[model samples]
Target: MIKLLIADDSALMRKLLQDIFVAEGDFDIRLARNGAEALDLVRSFDPQVITLDVQMPDMDGLTCLSQIMIEMPRPVVMVSSLTAEGAEETLEAIELGAVDFVAKPSGAVSLEIDRLRPVLVEKVRAASKARIRRTLRLTERVRHQMRSAVTARVRPKPARRRPVSGAGKPKQKPGPSALPGLVLIGSSTGGPAALDAVLPSLPGDFPWPVLVAQHLPASFTGPFARRLNSECQLSVVEVGNPMPLQAGTIYIARGDADVVVAARATGIIAMPAPARASYLWHPSVERMVLSALECIDAERMLGVMLTGMGNDGAAAMKKLSEGGGRTIAEAESTAVVWGMPGELVKNGGAGLVRPVDDIAEAIVELVGAHASH
Candidate 1:
């Protein structure tokens, strides 16, 4: 049975969540009246997943999260009110190692409870299985110290061109049947499972380089990449500084960094920014798509918007479409949350709407068809 600890100050909210989970019939539930009680239960009960309310009487959820993550790490889903401050704090909770969350509904208990059931169940499942990592603040100082030590031990090398793969083969003008130069994909929320379904279907020697941005907590992205690499045929690695893009390899953006694909004379540059502040979401899909557009012209680029909550990628997909690039948005039935890709389709940004299973094949065919012209 999945063990869950529901911590909230409001008795009704806690009871509602418990009812939702219990109705699902697969959970062992524990309730905490406040953050302090939750902490005590976390120590004794050792629950696999925790749902914490942001505002609490004794200790706030953020403080509880900091302590829990440091002492005994586990997946935490922040139960936040649907207020601006609540949203901001919930985002912070995500940054601080909470896996994900659901916005608490207001008014009409029956209706709100019904509306939240699906999201709550899904998030609880994802959180239960998520591999929780150490909070970034605790590790940042150590990481900084380690970085300084490493920098002192190593010497910078001169910039050299990375050789393009499969270059030695005789130039065969890729007839309209060849794949494009690069494939750029952006996703959030339910992206990992979607990508897992889509990526492994492509052949091992897939012709185009694949770049992806999956909105995720920094702590989760490393494990997420490992999980994808284990399941997929293609070699997947978390994109780091100065990593050169290579065909047949998939580069996943590390959380907390904006992933931008820049073209160079030798090969593609995987540009990562450590402190990008302008965008609301790190690894912003808009930034990634715009950068890809700069590197590969629209016709040679393929943009994909997958399931997510917000409209982060919609604007950029529009730019890509206007630039003559083909864009695909995940269909509603296939999406866990239809907010992101749904916006793209509604706004006329997407050139095609396809199921998750057909995305890779569609890209291959679309690029191949273009190459033949």
Candidate 2:
């Protein structure tokens, strides 16, 4: 049985979560009324995984999480509200080493939480198996502290910018000479922190336009894109509508839907589409890769599978490799959950396997070589 500790300020929420896990028949559970109680139990109970509620009394989830990570690091999943402020807090928790999160239904005393049973159980199970990298967390902690001050004073507001062509669609096709190589990235679970490590490493003048499909709820993607934009040299924007793809910019696929790339008459465009019944994960990586392949030649593409909990991109990336595209899988040592990338490596899809820190360097080398040839 998985040893699990659940911390929440609300008694109802604590019991609701406990009942969900108890029904699984595979978890040994403990409950904490707040972050302080949770911290106490972390030592006495020594649980394998923890589920933290963000708005706990006495000590908030963020403060408690920082201590737990520093004192006795373990896998944690934050139970967050589905609000903009909650999204920001959850992302901060992830950067401080939380493995994953489940957004609680909006409102107090929500029976709607029943809808999240599968997601909560699945993420907690995944968290139990996740690795905690102290070095990475410490490095992020310092940098996050530095950025916090600057960001608080002048944080960028999230907004939807008009696409290049004032029209809803591209008007005129740019010539083949305007086409640039594309890098497609798919991630989940430990994705945000992994993306933070990799994207910022690319230089300001990096050649290809990068696209990322990360599993998230609709409320979270805009803040996530803005957060990355502040940290990285390249501009980062959420693909809310059809936007022309350009080098030196990173497009984060909008959440709660699939974002696909299509060759428009004007140029290449990235746009959000309805989530297809065929794809299991939102912001579906599989759908994105297949869609891009339909328009862009595999030779002009690159597929990257980072730390995530499932085989979302494995098959399509394998096809990309077979069609002459390059692919990279995050090494087992660095991936908090190696499911996605591990599947790629196991299936002979990965052209290279590198730890998270080295991925940017590999991309630079490979893309530069492709550019030269």
Candidate 3:
């Protein structure tokens, strides 16, 4: 039996979680009513996977998570609310080494959390397979990747030369706008924190716009974009409707649907995801990449597959690559779950494999080369 721990402040919530997992029939469930109890049980139960609630009395989930990672790093799946604060903290948990998160379906005390039963079970299963690393080792690897990226050759800025005036004077102005085309990136599971590592590395003058479609709930995506915008130099916004694409901006798809790119005589436009049964992830990575191929030439686009569960973008990325598109897969060394990118690499879709911190450099190289042509 797979040893599992369920920790929450509410007795009702603990029993509720227990009942849900009990139905799965493969887990040996243990319960903790508070963080202190969870800490004690960590040694007694030695759970293989832990489902930890975000808010708890005495010691909160974040604090408990920090301690857990330090003393006994094990796979953790956060139970978070579908609210701004919850999303923010959940992302932090991922950065802290949690395998993934589950959105606690709308209610403080309602049984509606049961609505997440299917996803919760699957995530727990996935979490069990996660490789738990010590905090020091993980941090060092991330720093190394970032350092390597900075030292690597990347996108070249357009030459800036002053224009000669009527006489002998010269006038200075901002550099020319970034080249045409788009960069599409997709991820799930560990995506939030991975995105934070990558996006901030791309400068404000990054050539071509970026389109992102991560697996997120409607309530979380908006706040996620806002949070990303605060950290990254690029202007980030949550896509609401069809809008003209512009340079140096990153548009994140609405959580409930896909964001598709369509070519118009005027320019490229972003629209809501169309209904497609083939997709499993909400803002389906495959659907978005395929739709983007219609507007941006495959040879000019860069398709990046980041950490996530399943092969959401693998087939489409392979297709994109066959048509001369540049592709990258997040390296397993850094991936929280390498399923998506691992599939892509297995299918020969990616030309390069990089860690999350090094992806911005890869993007710059591909886009800059494409632009120079």
TM-score for every candidate vs. truth?
A: 0.57, 0.91, 0.83
> Tens digits of per-residue lDDT for model 1 on 1-373?
9999999998888888899999989999999999899999999999999999999987989778877866787888888765656655664465456767767787776678898898789778866865443212434422333344367524232222222222333212222332357788888765665675576665555567678888865555666666566545567878867667666577888777888877666666786776368786767888988888876778877888887767887998888899888899988877756778999999999999998867777876776677678
Give per-residue CA lDDT, model 3, range 289-364, as digits (tens): 9988876789978899998999998999899999999999999987878899999999989989997767888888
Question: Which residue pairs clash within candidate 1?
Answer: 175-371, 175-372, 176-371, 176-372
Using lDDT as the yardstick, the better of models 2 and 3 is 2
Q: Largest lDDT belongs to which candidate?
A: 2
Writing each residue's lDDT as its tens digit, candidate 2 over 242-276 gives 98888768999999999999988888999999999
| lDDT, each prediction | 0.74, 0.87, 0.79
**Candidate 1 weakest lDDT stretch, 10 residues:** 157-166
Give the winner by TM-score: 1 or 3: 3
Q: After superposition, how far is residue 160 of candidate 2 from its true place, in Å?
A: 27
Assess candidate 2 and give its lDDT: 0.87
Q: Clashes in each model (backbone N, CA, C under 3 Å)? A: 4, 2, 1
